[model samples]
Target: MYADPRRRPVTFFVGERVYLMMLMWKGVIWFGKRGKLAPRYIGPFSIGQLLNDQTVVLDLPAELFGIHDTFNVCYIHKCKVDDESQILSLQDLKVDMSKKLLEGPIRIVHRKVI
Candidate 1:
């Protein structure tokens, strides 16, 4: 017999600050990241509004301009800002036409016969 661990779902409120999880499949391509150097999260934007129980609007800064502000709870993560220096900033990123990440291959995985 095993006891089920207590699991509590996280929730975000209006005016709260949170970071958006950087999804690799979303087509984010960092300037110098080729393999393991790529970052996993992108922002600590503030919540603009609560669209619903599962969605929140973010106040993205000028650096992340031209992108949508609304995101689901799954894409948002809690940020621990103990000090101002703890904040992170992404210098540059590249995306495809759909605004998803477009990174090149890290190495040659397969080769064909001549």
Candidate 2:
């Protein structure tokens, strides 16, 4: 089939780290931010197990405990060793003990009154 030649097969192994695509919802806030600036993917989460050829379970952190662990291959991207900039650090986040994110003070860089 013509599709076969163009399609590339993606495989993931257990213990391999991968990034999971974050699905944007109307009102839900992913991580500490939301809207257009929000990250498209989160985690370099380790693969806990492969459920099927297309599905795998991820070892998500406690903060993301509410989300389902299983994900399809299309929803994940293999983590590259040299791409440190693509990874987001959870320690950089200002989360309180109650699992709430603390809002930092925002300063306006530019202002014009029309």
For lDDT, the strongest prediction is 2
Root-mean-square deviation (CA) per prediction: 12.9, 9.4
Model 1 lDDT per residue over 1-114, tens place:
486578677788888878887666546545345456676667778899998889999998776675688999999888878575656455434666785776766458699999
Question: Per-residue lDDT for 12-114 in model 2, tens only?
Answer: 8999989888788665546656777677877788999999999999998888777888988999999886566545575666777896878885457698999
Minimum summed lDDT over a 10-residue window in model 1 is located at: 25-34
Best by TM-score: 2
TM-score per prediction, in order, is 0.62, 0.68
RMSD of 1: 12.9
